[model samples]
Target: MDIVGDSGATGYGVVDPHNGWVAKMRLAMPNTRINNYAHDGAMVSDFLPGGRWPDTTDAVRRIGVDQPSLVFIELGGNEYYIDRDPAQYKANLETLTQNIWQVSPRSTIVYETIWPFDPRQSTSMHSWDEYGAAMQQLAVEYSAGWIDLRQFFPPHYADDTYTHLLNTDQIHPTDAGNVVEYTAVLNIINRC
Candidate 1:
């Protein structure tokens, strides 16, 4: 399996086995090899042609070459932080899906929704719901799998006292939160 996107997919376990979702996934599938192309604070543009850090060794290129049986993508949150237009984000996502298919047509591509951000800390104007809807639609359009993180970690802006799943930063998830996400992915894989 190969994962590409931002911090949520790459952060915890890429180096430290105790913290990342990828590490936990390895535990779930001990015999499986996992390659992670996720980067911290990466946006949709980062994966596009001629963008910042564009190279043949980028995630898309790796996907093309590795052709992993399964690929998981968790991006778009940074797009909201940068106030990127939703239409542009959708187009980038579509292009990404097409690229993945062109490279590995048989690989299962699972697009994970961006988890909700802390409303108080964010200055961006985009809506998470709208982004999620666009992603869901993309999943259908490309005949890919969709993993809605919101189902397990609902955003609670009104009551800060509520037992939120997010970390103190309110942008990233706690260790347990990562487990929730990994479990969801496992469930989706099992169904398939």
Candidate 2:
């Protein structure tokens, strides 16, 4: 399996991303290989021109020439930070889905929801709910997987108030938090 997205998927603020939850997954599977292309501060729209990372031509293109069997995506927080509308979020996700399917027809794509944040402190309020719906719709439309990680962290200003999942930044997950995410994702894979 391969992964891509923003800082959250990169295990930002934690140990080396490879040594993060991805490492846990690797340890558990042993035989399964996981490649992570999650860059820090990467937005869903960054794959295209006019956003940050103009160097990125396309989303799936960053995965190299090898076709991966599975891909887990976690983006949109940076998109929200950029104040992008949900329509654009949906469009970018659509393009990502199309590109991945084209590049790796046999690959199964799974979309992970962004971190749960206080909408009052965010740039746009509707982006969360709207983007979530968009992800679900796209998943169903493409026969892909969608894991709503929001359930793991319903935190607000205080990250560790409820669960010691979020870091002080209230964005990225802590080391233990990464384990939670990995466990959730692994559960889905085991069922399949």
Candidate 3:
């Protein structure tokens, strides 16, 4: 298995002690080796055509060489934060998945829906609801598996108190939250 995304998949060194979702997934499937190529602050454009970000594009190329059995992608939150056009976001996502297929045709592509951001920490011109819907449609069009984290984390935080699902920053998940993400990925991999 391979993981590609922004801080959510990378843990941004803040929750690294708990290990990211890829590490947890490796522990769950001890026989499997998971490669994580998630870069903090990466957006959908980073993986698109003419994108200058080498880390993401390099990872995609490495996938061709590594040829893992599965690849999980969790990105686009930054695109929303940067106020990218929804139509362009959709196109970039399509291009990304197509690039994945071109590199590792045998690998099963699993597209993770962007998690709902904590409104208190970040503001977005494009709503999480819009991103979620786009992800679902893209997953279907690309014939990839979909892991909707919204099923585990609510779209909005509670007004009364904090939750273990998200960290103090509310943008990233706490250690326990990573466990939730791990479990979700495990379920999807099993089904696949």
Query: Candidate 1 lDDT, tens digit per residue, 5-35?
Result: 8888875423344657777888878888788
TM-score-based ranking, best first? Answer: 3, 1, 2
For each candidate, what is the lDDT? 0.78, 0.75, 0.78
Q: For model 3, give the 10-residue run with minimal summed lDDT.
A: 155-164
Query: Residue 37 lDDT in model 1?
Result: 82
Give the C-alpha miss distance for residue 121 in model 3, angstroms: 9.4
Q: What is candidate 1's CA lDDT for residue 145?
A: 92
Candidate 2 Cα errors over 4 Å, as ranges: 15-19, 49-51, 54-59, 62-64, 119-123, 157-163
Error of 2 at 80 (Å): 1.7
Q: Estimate each model's TM-score.
A: 0.88, 0.86, 0.89
Q: Give the TM-score of candidate 1.
A: 0.88
**Per the 3 Å backbone cut-off, how many clashing residue pairs does candidate 2 have?**
0
Model 3: how far residue 154 lies from native, Å: 1.2
Give Cα distance to truth, residue 10, candidate 2, Å. Answer: 1.0
Candidate No. with top TM-score: 3
In the range 1-192, model 2's lDDT, one tens digit per residue, is 888777777777775555467777888889887887777888776665565664445446755465888888887887666667878888988987777777788888898886576544544556467777878888999888889987777765554365567776766788878887888889889877
Q: Lowest summed lDDT over 10 consecutive residues: which window, candidate 1? A: 10-19
